[model samples]
Target: MLIISPQTCTEGFAYDRGSRRCIDEDECRTQPDVCRGDMQCVNQNGGYLCLPRRLYDQPYRSEIPARPEATAQCLLGYTPAEDGSCDDIDECETNSHHCNPTQVCINTAGGYTCSCTEGYWLIGGQCQDIDECRYGYCQQLCANVPGSYSCSCNPGFILNPDSRTCQDVDECEDEPCTHGCFNTYGSFMCNCDEGFELASDGTSCIDLDECSFSEFLCQHRCVNTPGSFSCVCPPGYYVYEDGRSCEDINECDTGNNTCTTAQVCFNFQGGNTCLDALQCHSPYVEVSDNQCMCSAENPACRDKPFTILYRHMDLSSGRSVPADIFQMQATTRYPGAFYIFQIKSGNEGREFYMRQTSNVSATLVLSRPIKGPRELVLDLEMVTVNNVINFRGSSIIRLTVFVSEHPF
Candidate 1:
């Protein structure tokens, strides 16, 4: 070796010429402040230098500086642990935020945000009601609720049960014709017009007849009655009761029998009949009675014991009076006087003679005689006298007759 100086060879501590101080070479282990803040110290020949620390704390952080190898343990907003490491802060669990009271906080990767519930909106970071009615969201009338709204209709209207839409009500459909119910916007009305009367049910209208007042319907004279009238006619005119119309009566044409024998009949108004008498013809001889007779030798009497008669000879000829009460008589009897008589004209011919009479006292009864003068024939034959009879003989014999004119 080389000879060392006596000053530097006292111990391991020595004085260097560059620093000119006694130095302990192992002092870095006991006093680390001897290194620079950014440098590391190592056992070089005999001195040390400064080195940087492994990690550094942030500027505003309150924790100790960290090591690079422990990056996973560093908490962003928290202080370091006693072990010089970091842990999680968990701000979501702490409930510290500026969100609205009615909002919800949702934790994100690095922070949190706020939001409202259903039917609400976030306005300026606060919850507000979404007015669904204002923007026509409701189909009908709208009602507002907390943070929401509903739909409904006003009075006098109804919402359709299916569609939820407002509609007008028809009140007239239920009670139709209620005084003529009229439907309007949301209601109905009731009334009637003039010249009409409302019925008891207030639905129908009725009419009144003005013709029941007076008898203005008839012409000359009027008789007013219930629902009808009549007209009257003057005298000499009779109204037919069937239709009440007037007509004339002809009294003269109606035959009212008022007449006597041998009379002419006439008619008048109100049914009257009249009569006048007739005359008889002249006689061949005047007899003791009111009739005309003939003697036995008279040319009108064809033979002796003479007689005269008159009668109706035809069936069509009507009858005259006293049909069955006449006789011819002789006071002095002649024994065998044969007499024959024949009717000239009228119904009397069938009723006058009887077959049992053939003597002088035989009789002929007259039924009805002809209206004018009529002639008849009789013949008599005198065989012999009964005894010596007196020959005093009157020239004429008379008879009286009564008469009725009609056949009935």
Candidate 2:
């Protein structure tokens, strides 16, 4: 065994028992070279060792001096432990990290940080809301929530939980028709009132013509429109008591007359007419103020005297006159004893005469009165040549009569 002298015992040197030789040992305990001035030393079995640690100073060092202690090295996001060892501080759990309130925390190896929640993003260490709607994250529509989001359905739709999508509900399929039903934007509507029905296109309602089908309601024509119906009478007919029926018009009784002058009105079945009373006669004369004026100026005289005939009749009477009583006249002088003869009973019967004779003039005067209204028969015979004679020998005679009726 090699034994070393006590004076040859250098710092951190130890004796090997098996080899009997001195081994080089760590000089951390005896020499200050192992530990910096800020570190403390600890002695080991084979050698005295220096332990790297930090001391609590009243004023902490503004600048960290260079250190040879391995344990005294300051790591990122952590400081040395109070016992001069390195330890990590859970900044995330202790909430010591600066981050937005809406953010979440995550722990790392030596430090902690913040991040956004689900459906959100972290930008510049701050939480930002993500638009899930733009990314088609929702089945129908998506809404962004604070640090989160949700899915919903649009208007006029309902969310289907099984499918997680929106589905449309048909309002018209529910048989909602009172008269008829129409579907619109998320809703439905019924048709009009009882008298109305929905149109073919299903938007508008139109009135039914009850008058057309039932006769007791309307007595005449029925007209139907969008919402109502009307009843009307025929032409030339007026509404009756029912306000819908028609009645015939009496034009004559209503004083609707269409007639000409000098004519008699005769009412017929539907209308009236005007009749000429003297058209059947050869010399037709019109009576005005109970007098008949001759239409022609003169009559042709063949031999001696000429006679003119007149009929006294009512214009409005529909009767006619007899034709056998008109004849020629006989006369000799201008103013002889003028007389009117009347046959009383038979053809050759008693006669009456007048004694007076008036002056000759354009007007002829009857000497005597006739008993009944018969045809006047006159015969005029020429007496001598007179100044009234001409080559043509034409004459016009006008007669005036005054009658007196005596009861027999």
Candidate 3:
């Protein structure tokens, strides 16, 4: 209704001055360059539309696939539709995007972008793996995942339910240590009871060798046992109540000495001695070799033992000293008993003389002259005469006289 000139028609319309109204414009047949070269212009009611052809299948413009028309403009991450209009490609939904699994797919106006989540950062167009352990994310330990991290604890500790803090594991609650368990930071220790020590593995207890240590209370010989010790002494010794000091025992006082009827037992400090029996008269003395003789006050002796002792003399000069050969004291309970003696057998009997000095005793004298060093053997026979009581007596006595040239 407001037409001013014939050229005032729209780009796709025609001018009809007779009807004075805008009609359909077929610009494709009139103006050949109404649309882009990569698109074909088609006629419409009031305008012209550009359509996609098979030759415009390429994504980017290049000189090899040159077009006779101007270059086409398409939206980012979009391709031309059949009506020559840009449309979204939906690369993420179609699994055609190059975004990593740890990155999120974002559709831009012209393209799509790969981005990390809230916990991750960008690195080289990819999500950067953040070591949460380096930043002390976990209380004790941390583990990095794809786009997040996990929290953990060290030994003897466990992660809390919140997954961000740590707490003690309570290893002692499980009865891990056989002895005693002490909890510490991220670890545990084993303690022993009295008189015991912990083993190398820190899980068990071992018995302490009390004797092996230098501070052992035992004073004497110590015997070691498991967690104990003992002190002892040798045989024939008595240990005190302290279990260390010892004292000798008196065997004589305890009646352990084996003294006979003829021997007397005398006890010293730690030992005993057995002495001979004093069977001599009041004034007589006991001589060496168990012999009895007359004293100055009293000339008589009694109850002498039946013993023969050898007298060694030098005979190299063929002469001998005046030696008393024989003597016998009376053992009869009744005093004043007559005794007679005679030689039964001997080699050279004439070299000896017999003397009957008293009725209770007798003596034999050897001759002072001898031929050479020789052993002499003699046998004597004795009998009690005029005895009030006939007592037990031996009638025979064998004597051996040894003479040597070396003053024996």
Q: What are the lDDT scores of the predictions, listed in order?
A: 0.45, 0.47, 0.59
Q: What is the lDDT of residue 176 in candidate 1?
A: 59
Give candidate 2's error at residue 272 in angstroms: 25
Query: Which regions of candidate 2 are displaced past 4 Å?
Result: 1-88, 98-102, 136-143, 150-155, 162-164, 173-175, 182-195, 198-206, 209-220, 223-408
What is the C-alpha lDDT profile of model 1 across 39-68, one tens digit per residue?
555432233334344322333233545665
In model 1, where is the ten-residue run with the lowest total lDDT? 308-317
Which candidate tops lDDT? 3
Per-residue lDDT of 357 in model 3: 71
From the highest TM-score down, the ranking of the candidates is 3, 2, 1
Model 1 lDDT at residue 406: 19
TM-score of 3: 0.37
lDDT value for model 2: 0.47
lDDT of 3 by residue, 1-408 (tens): 333346544444567888774566677888878787678675644445576654335454333443445444563457755554567778777677888877787664434556556565545555665555666767777888865678877777878999989888767777888778997777788898777888898889888877677644554467766656666655434667877554545566787888886786654323445656655454444565444445433433233223322222222224354667567545663465566766656746488766777765667676666653466776655665555565433344556554432221
**lDDT-better candidate, 1 vs 3:** 3
Error of 2 at 13 (Å): 58
Q: Where in model 1 is the C-alpha error above 4 Å?
A: 1-94, 107-110, 160-164, 176-408
- Clash count of each predicted structure: 17, 11, 3
